[model samples]
Target: MIHRSISEYFSPYTLQKVEVDGKEGYVLIDREGYYKGPDEGIDIALKLLLAYGDAGIQKALDDENKSIHLENMGFDFQKTGRYVRHGKPVYKRGEFDLFKRVWSFHCGFCGKKVSIDVQPEYWYIVDQHGIRKSNTLSDRACSEICAKHIWDEYLELWLKNNRYSTELGK
Candidate 1:
């Protein structure tokens, strides 16, 4: 059993209301920069930040600072790395650390060991559907071969259930 508080996981930051482009929204302030999102309340914003994870939130802040620096230097667009989608800056997604944390596990298909020796690309994390815990996966594959085999089996079931109505009538 792990005991932890919400505050324990979050980095020190301040939340406040701010106006951007004549529209009101909330911003979270930290040492690096502020995170601006929709006009959602403070609680929702906090939840969003928490879901993004500490490292992700820091990345967003750093990206924002970099953007500001470039704009100040008269660059119309960022030099590299940052992505803009539909006129808003899109931050990079953080690397999922679950694989590293649960390093010692048997392949869900063949019961093979998944380790650093087994190149990272070969392994797959299969998120189980309809499970009680979101933190865990229903199955994992130690190699690409196992993953494809498992997916092929799953696809058969999916096709059976999702067949066209006309095809079923025939």
Candidate 2:
């Protein structure tokens, strides 16, 4: 049961207990059709104190929590940090507008939030069908090292898949 003030702080939203990583956690759901967590409900409430007037934190939490669902669906999320939409990567290089909206991306390698102001580099492989072949998330890399790491993972997946297909054909 969450406290009343906490509920109002995230007004119009309510908490629902849900299992995460085999443990009990709470997710925030709202009438407006927004979903926020599968985390310790109290933890999110406490974070509000540190949010420092950043309304975007709620959206960020929603984005991060999405990984839980992705993993539950058997996505090799850790190996390839990618998500696709309409057979294309959800995020693209050189696509950002800080003035228009908060641009927050989880680093492909480290899982840290990429700096909002920095233009992030995207690494992915598109197959002939225009489907992205990598399982990694299509978010930005925080640095050259992270970018290299993402590329290496994608290249490895591509090579492994190609090897399997070649073997099966013979």
Candidate 3:
């Protein structure tokens, strides 16, 4: 498993907060500016190593400073940041646009053609390989916004059915 010194684990880029149920939760992100140039190379290498173990993280550490220089050898991982392993899109248009985008999504479904939106403001993917609708599809701009209603409903139902499991996090 990946491990870090207490200081590295609690770095500013890492976010920590108490959940609604009072459990601590956190995540990391590659901080901006600090992740430029050589840091980019290190980031790629470290990610690959994360799959195996913290061997990469340890190797990246500096002999004198003892700091890994994550920005140089890996991501400036933060507990809070914008990137997500899997994120949807959110649109900025009016309700009419949302409906229109849905109509287009339906059309694509009916036509059996892939439709996709390239811009974050129009994400509307039906599936991993479905069309992109980041422009016309409000769901494509942001995944959470697109899936919030459905996800919330499903989660509510699941929680109700599985009352014994009483923990959740963001």
TM-score top scorer: 2
All candidates' TM-scores? Answer: 0.29, 0.31, 0.20
Q: Estimate the overall C-alpha local distance difference test score of candidate 1.
A: 0.48
Residue range 1-170, candidate 1, lDDT tens digits = 22337876566666767799999965666646656345434676678777676666666666666545445433343332212223432222123354566455666578877655554434443332321124233245666667645544443343355341212111
Show where candidate 2 strays beyond 4 Å: 1-96, 117-131, 134-137, 164-170
**Clash tally for model 2:** 7
Specify the highest-lDDT model's number.
2
Sort all candidates by TM-score, best to worst: 2, 1, 3
Per-residue lDDT, model 3, residue 128, is: 26
Put down candidate 3 lDDT per residue, 1-170, tens digits, no spaces: 24567776754343324365677743344455232344655665587577547655544443323224323322222432212112322212222243355332322212222233422232233332111223233232233344444333333444345341223323
lDDT (Cα, 0-100) at 89 in candidate 2: 49
Give candidate 1 misplaced runs (Cα > 4 Å).
1-102, 117-121, 125-138, 164-170
- lDDT of each candidate versus the true structure: 0.48, 0.51, 0.35
- Candidate 3, which ten residues in sequence have the lowest lDDT sum? 82-91
lDDT (10s digit) by residue, model 2, range 24-105 = 9767887776786546455667776767457677766665555444444334434544443233443335445556766566
